[model samples]
Target chain A: MSTRPLALLLLALACTLRPAEDHVRLDERVGRAETPDTLVLEEDGLAAIREATPRGARLWAASPVLHLRLRTAGGPFELVVRNTLRDATLTLDDGTVIEREPGGLPTEARFVLDLPAGVERTARLAPPDADAAGSFHVAVLSDVQDAIGEVQDIYERMRADPSLRFVVSTGDLTDSGTRAQLVRFQEELETLPIPLYSTVGNHEVPGPEAWHDLFGPFNAFFRFRGVAFSLVDSSTATVDPALRRERLRPWLEAHRDAPHLFLTHVPILDASGLRSGAFRSRNEAASLLQELADAEVDALFFGHVHSYYAYSLAGIESYIAGGGGAIEEELDGIGRHYLRVEVDGARGVLGVGLVRVD
Target chain B: MTRRHGRRAQVTAHLLLALVAAGLPAARVAAQAPRTDPSADAPAEPPPPEAEPPRCSRARRRAAPALALTAGLLLHGTGHLLACERRTGRRLLAAEGLGFGALVLGGGGIALTGASRKTVAPFATLAILGVGTFAASWLADLYGTLSGGANAGRPARAAPFELALGYRYVHDPQFAYGHGLHLAAEGWLHRTRLFGGAWLALDDDTQRATAGLSQRLLGARGRGDALDAEAALHGQRFGTDGFRTLGVDVLLRGRLELAHLGPTLAGSFVEAEVGLGLQGFGYDATGRGVREDWNGLLLGRVGWGVFLGPSGELVAYYDHRRDDLAGGLSVDSVASGVLGHFGLAGRGYIRDGRWGLAGELELGSALVVGLSVLHRGAAPREGGAR
Candidate 1:
């Protein structure tokens, strides 16, 4: 064949070798910009309650206090604290002097409910005649991105045991919150067979509208089982003095009563006692967290900074589940993992397991 | 030029025909392996109690892509040796001889690995290409005469078709600052001698094809085989993010092609050259002289090919070139000829990944390099990821 004809033939062959597919779908799920209906906070209506007055704290104020008015099975309970610091002690309603550290409520501190001397064993543990109640299990997961296999593995493990009541994602549900990314999360969790709750992290807030929409009905401050779980908006954690004093203070005071499990994105004040502020703020917001910790809140779970960090502060136990998402680099001490919590009656047992999926 | 173009067209067509004949049949075999839906029979198979698939041998998985790439390189090498216009008959014979030897070695390596262990295919193919490069480089040193004309002595440039396949491993010294190093199969095929006209094959489906022709003319030189001037006319293309590129380079290379090595390798020439390439950056396929800039390159090479032999013998000393992109994005064009191919068994040359350096000049620019590693066996398939 002539060179022209031969060239034409080769061109034809090259053209015929069309690629298998033209558009390679990339990971593009930026999640629903607005809260999805299922994730909204509608079921727990009391969470909708707004405080009549805005409350706050001042650093200059001497000896700030957290007034605790919690009601247990036996009767109404009240404790008093003078300041927010390490090893602060609390006096229980029954004049029980508890030498409390500025960490989770003393692990051994438990109220031995008074029951009839001849009460049945079942009734003793679960009193049908109790004045106070407890029946909520919140799932806490961290560092769920970057390692899809690990996430899937954890999800599968959870699925095997249907006892899992509900799930709480500490934060960092994604490496990058691309649209498809959120979809992957939703698809993986759809098999969970229970509602999944999320506390907003820096990753979740590239824009308020998107995250607020993705976790709609389930995204609100609400009471689950019986414990009140509060999600502290990172927006309120900013260095903006006005936002800190005006916004966060009121939110904390209004939800002070019920057995509380606080959720936050960033860990407050590193071991060196320095606080991080959003938008380049300093330790200004540390006092607010101190006040809450003094109130003897339940475990506070957080994500971001993919590593496992646990600390105790003013009668409160704080657990960091940052390993729930993508882990960019290996930490000196922590591996990727999720916390499986078994909560029954008044006490909860937390176990951490490092999971890997091929 | 017309005769050269005609021969190239013929060879390309022949290669295309051969590739199609070989690739289509194997593709059919794969297509027949039950493409309908394995998910349908799930009820009977009962998911393997194990949740994840066992780790398969990496060599087995990479075989198809390896073969495809290897074949492409051999075909490309053959095209260049046959179509090059300025090369002497002796040089041409040696180039073809080297190319054929590379194909045989690469093929044998693949088959041996397959018969014994699947993991050795990529390494085998890499060995084949390494040897083939040395042959071509040595041949270039012989027949490619220098321009002793107006400016000074420089090699008469030949636009040989260049193609290669290899496996690559890269690691950045600064761990925290940049992305981690990765292992990938890569290849590139080009028909321009200026190192300016080439299509990079990243993975399998993505091919960044350079549009337009590039011409490099020789110029004056100083001692030590250095060139005084070099020129080029290239087309460029840029797509998404920092990957934006589509510009032509027009340069006058002031470098020598043959170097005078003393007595050991008598009359065997070894040369080094360096010069500036006036580059034009624009959004045109025909990369003709557009918005131009002075881009520089440095080349050094040496070879010894006997005048008579069934398969002309030549030792390719070295061939290296570097180009810098003005402003923030600078690319260092390189093609080094390693001493010997130890892993695949024989005396051969190796072309490390084509590295492009960026970042702080004081600390030296960061590099994004390309590699083409091959092993012996049936030639790797050409239509998949490298």
Candidate 2:
């Protein structure tokens, strides 16, 4: 009947038009340019180019390292990079040194470069000692909702740790995830001496469309030193099937032989199933854990419950660090804190120690 | 199954059976209670005067259902006790105690084991059965107080055989499939029911199929009041996602006629099922060709329904499994992980009970709507009349 065909057509249209807002777009957007003057990101990392022109560009880098390509007109050009780790190094193609200007915000790294007109050059910006990779320390923090005013103290404490490379987060950088709240959270980050890479949390669902533009992406993968870090979005308590297939499978495969640390906004399975601060589907969670185990991931980190927990899931070391001044879990002596994880290129994860800020 | 697993399964099965059996005899007695006084046939001798049974006050009768909605919701039998159905009330309360015991033991086991794959299935099964029994007792208590012992012992019958073909629409932002063809067939063989169904996507390669057999454990076949033990095999392929799953589950399902509880509940029934399963997922992508994983599934369902005429019924249900196409609801809180989906479904005959229409709506992370045209064979001669 005519009705059946009409119904089929409507179904097709609905399926085609379903909102596909997920982290996969961020993966595809990197290393792509809309115009010749636009900066092109090359690595599987999280960064956003805020402004681009013929002579200069300003960018925000959430990941510790950025591999980019850009074209510039002849003469001196100013490249301002914000939200970068301390002691970042900028170099031209194949290690040509470019010094950063002094006396800027501790989290900002400003570079001035001179180049020939109409020439495109590759640029690599990273920590000075990133490649040495014997053993390094990184801090993990999350759940700063409602506590944005007090998060700076935790950052200050991390700044005091000279060995900490950068901070990684599971999400909940803001209480409401509004653009204004996100911007305010970013403003507070200016005081930190290190960069923070994060996935979005459930708090961000109210404004899901805004987070991609502000935080780079909900799901991203990057390699630092010798460790592979994959940040996935479980803010909705489930991963989009397309994301699981298109991005996660490949990321896990690519890092199968390396030391991989998986981070997400929600734990795949709550430890006791009492709090249920985990994925909506236990079957999906168990399947994912099996995959992680099969891939031999080194560790997993999550933040949602406002407390600290260290446990093993599917034989992988896991931790939940949500002590960023949110409503604290009552009765527990511990308060605001973060995790300091040490990993070695050859030896895998060495230790994860809890650093209390309150 | 291994020896240890078999032993655990036996233990879990015994626990569930004990909980269910606690209410079985009482239900049977209530069902078989005499509808008419046999003494009418006796010679008319001067009847000995007997003290009338204490009557429920009008105020107490009015308050019974309200109490069921409040205190009885948690205590499981307050309303029945208030209505002076002390024997049934005590049985319900005892059932609730056993249910809570199973819940504690199963939940404690899962917590202590960290939900380890080796021991999760039996523990989860026990827990689901516990929750189902607990809820059923509460519902029974409410029905007993509200129905007022009217229209006692009426039975509802189901068609002995049926075949259906239908169209299904699914809307999920996470996947690409939208349209599907639904096919199902079910028939009774003596005291057992055999059933199979499939959902094939028209716009994508997604396909799912399930086949099962259920044996009547108590009550008569084709009757509303029955207990069944079912074993089913399930398979699904998510072509858009390049993954497939295969699994098997064993469930104990029961449907109790509400008329046994009270008159207002006549022609209505309550159903509950609890089960456990294990599923294996395999990926079809290039790098994931060798990638496979397994998961333990805890399945539970509870429903309340009313019979339509002699061969049709409408039901509203809550399903606690997430592996189906409907999946679990997505929310910003942990409750998303703890709860599943709710659904409404109905079936009715139009052509002398040989042809019928069926429809369903399910609400979860996705929305699923389905409508079917069905044909049924002749009903069995015995047990076909209501």
Candidate 3:
């Protein structure tokens, strides 16, 4: 055989092996975004700076924690952060507290910082109540596809609960992942009392790559009060093989000894195999489950099936809570609901409660 | 272009390239061989000599193809019945019915059990078998309808033993393996057939091997159409990925001669198999030392093919399993979640049946292409009739 065909085949293989752009863009925006001549903002997790200026910055904290380093010429600065729990507080490295002012939106928190000229001062912002090694509650919601209009009521219900720290979603935040729809979803989040972290779902694939641009990273990890949360992108029914090997495996390994909760848009193995609302390959699913089992993950959460299911796989507690008011799966009798998961730093998941909105 | 469109274009281009590559050799063989009745070289036992049967009219023959293309595609065997092959039609229909029954039972079991891993092996096996039988019957119906009726000549039987050596190319985005050396051997002794194969990746440190034995349950092994009960053991080591797997399976496999369905379907055959297996995956690089986990595996295959001369055959098949190298598709549709991989394979002997050439292509989560040279220990035997 001529080497020409072999060379062409190799070229084609190389071209095809290129990773998905969504993951690349996501990796780029995870840690920090910079604005020249202004303060440099750094986040411990998958947060994004929607707007940045010399005096202040608008932040979307995908995770509950943010670390900001100011490079100002000794003056007062204002910082506005969104998607944070109600009890969030800002404190200087010297242990001085910075009181939060009432922002324009209920979910927003504004803090004034006085910085010494030519000296970079670091500030830590986080929910103080969730920082301890005690049990806390978090709300889980997903699949608000066409129900974007009706999600406010769900958030209202969440807001009424004083015990809930924040919300985490498995994805499908809009009917389509269009920029307008994503912005609308974020706008509605202003009604909620706490932050909502999410991974993208299959429904988000159709519209151009606006989900990541608007909502930060599709894959992320964070720790709240000692409990580890890992969110992965299964929007296309399969995680990119590279992502699984390089990102997911490391995330699992890093939190192997902690009380880790894994969340993704699609279930790795659908409890009801008939619907197959899960990974594209059962082998892949099996492999992933084995990895999780080896790591001793506390629980798995997923949303895509439009109904709720609580099942166990590989000895780990798993739940599918897709009841965010999308078209319902009829006759199941459960609709428009979210899960209230309680976790402790010292212990694993305490319990998962189902909260119905309608 | 958009990413989706780009990916589609790439897949289409590769598919076309594979088609052209596969067609060239087959086309060359076709041109070299004489244009004669395909049944003259059928690899099945000949029917006992009998009085001449009335031939169907041209319109009836044409109608069979039409029916097969239309209703027969869904209602398998309708075309065979229309062509007056009552026994074969009824058998095909029975197979279809049994397939559906198995599907229902298996699906219901899976749902009832909540797809629990404990009891999933048997149910999944049934489901895979059901799907394979259903599809194979339909394809068989189409083949029987299109093949022109020819004399049911006995021709020659299959070689008793064969050895093959080959090279395989695999393109999987998940792995770095690109080239593999393949070796295989199979032999028949009395009523049993034993086969073994190995694939060693040349570019990466991955190796896989499979060994199997099948006991003939019905029909003659020499005729190349039989019902077999098989047991197989397979193992693979992904040296670069720090993992390995070992599995064993038992299957009930059958190959039916389409000529038995009708003389018009001479020289063609359909095969179906379903099985269950247990596999253990061992990981070497986890936080905890080496860890091993087990999972249930469902295996199934269905194919349609035609005999090539007296000792060769070409087949197109669907393999409903993901544990192998081809794995499963990673598409953006629900099919990615449910469907398996597709493949095409062919082998033909030359140089007085002492040497042969084989080629294969598989499409799944990966694309695999392989070509091999075969050496036969014995030439096909002649003078046998059913």
lDDT of candidate 2 over A261-293, digit per residue (tens): 899888886653434556765546655766677
What's the TM for model 2?
0.64
Model 3 Cα shift for residue A4 (angstroms): 14
Query: In candidate 1, how many Å is residue B306 off?
Result: 68
DockQ of every candidate: 0.00, 0.13, 0.18
Query: Evaluated on chain B only, what are the TM-scores of all the candidate structures, in order?
Result: 0.26, 0.73, 0.75
Candidate 1 lDDT over residue span A118-233, tens digit each:
22111111112122454434457765655554576666766675655556665557645555665576666654544456655555444334343344311235443345566554
Inter-residue clash pairs, candidate 3: A74-A117, B149-B264
Give residue A124's lDDT in candidate 2 (0 to 100).
88
Candidate 2, A265: how far from true, in Å? 2.0
Q: What docking grade does candidate 2 earn?
A: incorrect
Q: Which is the winner by DockQ between candidate 1 and candidate 3?
A: 3
Q: B236-262 in candidate 1: lDDT tens per residue? A: 233211112223333232222222210
Candidate 3 at A298: error in angstroms?
3.5
Give model 3's docking category. Answer: incorrect
Docking class of predicted structure 1:
incorrect
Q: Compose the digit string of candidate 2's lDDT tens values, residues B51-94.
A: 32489677877798899889987777778778766655665676
